[model samples]
Target chain A: MDQFLQLIVAGLATGAIYALAAIGFTLVWQTSQTINFAQGEFVMLPAILVLTAAHLGLPMGVAFIVGSVAFVLLFGFGFKRFLVEPMQRHGVLPLAIATMALSVLIKEAAKNGFSAEAQPFPSLVPDGSVSVLGAAVSVRDIAIFVVAIAAILGLQAFITHTRTGRTMQATAQNPTVARILGVPVERMILLTFLINAALALIASYLISPVYLAKFSNGETIGLAAFIAAIVGGFNQIRGALAGGFLIGLIDNLAAAYVSSAYRTAVPLVVLVVVILVKPEGLLGRKEERTV
Target chain B: MLFKTMAAAIALTAAMTVSAVAGTVKLIDVIELSGPGAPAGTNWKNGSDLAVAEINAKGGILGQQIELIHYDSQTNPGATRAAVQRAVDEDAYVVLGPIFSGPISASMQITQRAGVPQIVGGEAAAFTRQGNNYIFRTSLNQADSMPKLANYLRDEVKAKSVAVVWINNDFGKGGRDSMIPELQKRGIQVAADIATESGQADFAADAIKVKNANADAVFVYLNEEESARFLRAARQQGIAKPIIGETTLLGAKVIELAGEAANGVKGHVGLLVDAPKPTLVEFGKKYAAKYGFTSDHNGIKGYTAVYTVKAITERIGKLDREAFAKALHGARIDVAQEPGILIDTKWTATGDVDRESFLIEIVNGKPVVKATLPMINP
Candidate 1:
């Protein structure tokens, strides 16, 4: 029972990271109707940026701020203005393809421009363990779980209650109608991209300490988050969060009980089953035939 | 008389030009410089350059200046194959790396076919078993090192059941494969055997499983970075079992990254800086003076490999590729013959090397040598 509790807590903590990463990926797809394939690279950029800044003799806080400004301008505003906007004209698929190209380009740039060696990140949470039901759970894991739940709550409150969030949702649903209703549709879309960039930075800061920061980390985290978004439902923020936790929990349980080599296979099999059975995902909204 | 004298002067100048141009011998270095292997690859590259510089300063190898050219393997097997082909195409006298077993396996066949000697730093058990006569290793392969490690597990630790957590790559898989049978031979029970991916982030589950297995000791077979993550995770989970691994786990990078977590972990070190040898002590100091950071096992591998080539060439009395390969079938290059060889190293017919290695424990973030195991052949 003690061992089981440890696995559960660890699994949930892993899920929290996936949940945070999934939100960013889902946010971009929700507003732009295009999945930013480089969602994982966005998570990597901030960690590298901070590392570079620290190497150049800047304080950690200052380096983080510098990294934030750079990430927002380059990924949020510039990405939507240049890559997504230009590519969205052809089709959503083309925009997705462009994001993938951006992922490859960013990966190479990070590998060559920065160091390829992995470095331990300066974690926000204190380094210690907390005994939860005799499991001795890491303090970092609790922080990550709290942050993920908070993000989900914040998303619900903002989209339902706030003016700008409603406007952003209106634009995602129908840009033509939103623009006719005197909404600045382009600005709202840019806001979504900016929100995604912020989420990526947060995810990087949290996960880097556990995983270590390196150039190639995007593939593992990025692919998992992409799957989480699909499993949770692309249309709903809460679904994405739930999807992240589900994948993390499944991954941990599978590895603990089954063979570690086949641990990754279990989540994938669940994803396939979800796709075959639900088509709209476990929490995805089904299209009504009323029209 | 004037016509004959002018012709003689022209002939003299032509002969002098030929001597000047022909006084160079080229060796191509194919190493992982830009990818996952960068950490180990960079150290090997630096050590190779240091040896080249030292040899050139002492009037060159066999009186010809060493022309060392480097090509990036990108830590990919295909890239390594391409790099080796490029080296062969350029008519290199030798090829120096692609340290990872996967890349070295992809590349060694090219050098074998080309009849060019290639010295590698890969330590997988299957490294020298592929019938490639021209390829040689500068360190102990898993086949030789695992038995020593198993002995340590049996004699030193007195552990009956040992769990093995290994990476699922060429290097890690080979180590795990070699270790299991060796443990069986020594009557040690195999506990939880867990396989992990390269660059995998989360290890809490792995830690939980290893702890739950209740094994007497844990054998971690992974790259340096992954080992550090595992070390920290194990410590965080309060795993107090004696964890053992090869040089990769006990290496400088793993120690630095693992910090307080790496303390007291035991491993069989093949080529480390703290081997309790005067030559190694000197080499480590010199390497630090030249390169700022401490030299890891890869650096020692790269440094000794250069001297092996020079010593073999000198013993053969010529630089013929075929002769050099033939002479190295059963060659012993002692430190007396070449101080740069560092220790007495013997090469088998299949290109595997036998040398002195150390059993070490990481104490306070340093590799403290516990015992020196002499050459198996000796």
Candidate 2:
């Protein structure tokens, strides 16, 4: 049915955003063995910064690039260096708590510095809809889907083909052994954070136009992405991507077909079912530790 | 020696009475002045502040200067509760706000227990139904407003089939509950009833469902940001049905956020800055000059609340909580603060004001008044 097709298109577009956000979480977790609870804050920060830059008279394109790069250095690099690096030596719990604190700090800072009112962010694509297979789809939605898919594919290629990417993967697998084998484990971890931050900015740029850029949006996007990562496979990038799409699809389908009142509960249900059935997640490999 | 001691005791008692008579009457405002709700909260504060300033300049209430003490709720219920306790501890003559419904509901218990008169502008119908005598709402309740909205949809817009999309909160649910039955009464079929989370960004799924239902009009009940987002999403998905929304969509935030996409959407608005009334125009100009921005419905409600309290206090000639509550319970006073918007400020037994609701359509990024719906009891 045309209605079903419409829901599918919308679902795919929404899923792409979740996929990018989940990728941000999975990347940091894989490299550092620590979940960046603030991954959602990263999605909000760059969009707000870019909006601020644009308001300050910078060209939109220039503002986007500058905002993304500045936030990566300040928050991404600064967080890893100042908060994560120091607390990581103590324990994973401390590091995770630090990330949670970082998220709150970022959210509060944005609320105070920027207006609490949700501001309109300019879309990358033009404003219009096209009939695709009898379902009307917004140009922005299509652009988001294409861009997100391309970014994921590009990341896949980078990990498979590049020496630095392979070295980063090796570091993620076993930092101690990777370091002993001459891999720069510290640098790889930092690079992973940078990548995660970049991915978050990309997702923000895609989604902000639809959602409107607000400081509180971080929690909504962050929680969904966290759920996606956990449900897909917290340690696997591909699994996280698949999990993100699954959530996006289910959320939309549930709202369309079932009760919209229970749409928000769908993701939590998936998370609970996944946790109960397979603690390692659908695609996660069980850890084999030697005593 | 006995006569001298008796005279001294009388003198001390006389001094205490004189000091009490000359003391300033303090009104406490427990409202969100920070966090996400800050913009509206600031407007409310400014409105009340302006009213107090004007009242003091003319002459103090009952010859005693009025002092307003504002405690930030920070959009949290715990903070609101703490603020209410602070107001009680300060021995405030009356308390003004906690703008959002949830905070107002949470703080109502404290105010009721303390027996402090609390006047709120939140639109939740449940705020009045709690059987609390001290709680008064100055804004239009959904019970009174939504039926008029449904009437407009039936008579003016002439839509037969309607799709209802509302945020799943007290305010939204109240609107939805009141609206559905009203529509049914008029023989308008509700094709789809969709509930959305507050602050939800993506509305494609919801929009798609509404589109699929193929209703003549879509009625939306959401906050400012969510309304803007939904409007944008719906328009983008090529759903061109007539969209009728609650007052939240007619706000400046919705215009700024939704841009051109907001055009053609009609809704019920409590206050319009461009209303052709001389008093309202003057108030708008004064408010803009003072606050450095245009005032919204919240500001108007806040401004009117102060005058309402002033009216009550002037009638009683003192700050007696019980007397003030009794006076406000079915009293009608002509609100002089913002005349046209909230003119005949009549309170029902349940403390809801009998105020007119105006219909507005967004045109060229501004709300243009279409029709005025007189207050009708639900």
Candidate that scores best on DockQ = 2
The CAPRI class of candidate 2 is medium
Cα misplacement distance, residue B193 of candidate 2 (Å): 1.0
Steric overlap count per candidate: 0, 0
Model 2 lDDT per residue over B1-378, tens place: 999999999864543233235477688998877754665687788889988898888776777777898999987788999999999877777899978887888889887887788999788788899789999986788877787788889998899999999988777888888899999999999999988876677888888888889999999888777788888888878888999987777776677788888999998876657665566667778899997777877787688778877788778776677788989998878646434234666788888778666889989987888877766642
Interface RMSD of each: 2.0, 2.0
Error of 1 at A83 (Å): 2.1
lDDT of 2 by residue, A178-231 (tens): 999999889888988888877888899899999988888888789888888888
Least accurate stretch of 10 residues (summed lDDT) in model 1 chain B? B12-21
Assess candidate 1 and give its lDDT: 0.85
Assess every candidate by TM-score: 0.92, 0.91
**How far in Å is the alpha carbon of B55 misplaced in model 2?**
3.5
True contacts kept of each: 0.57, 0.77
Q: On residues B106-215, what C-alpha lDDT tens digit does candidate 1 reach at each position?
A: 77889998788999999997969988889999889899999999999999999999999999889989999999999999999998899987667678889989988999
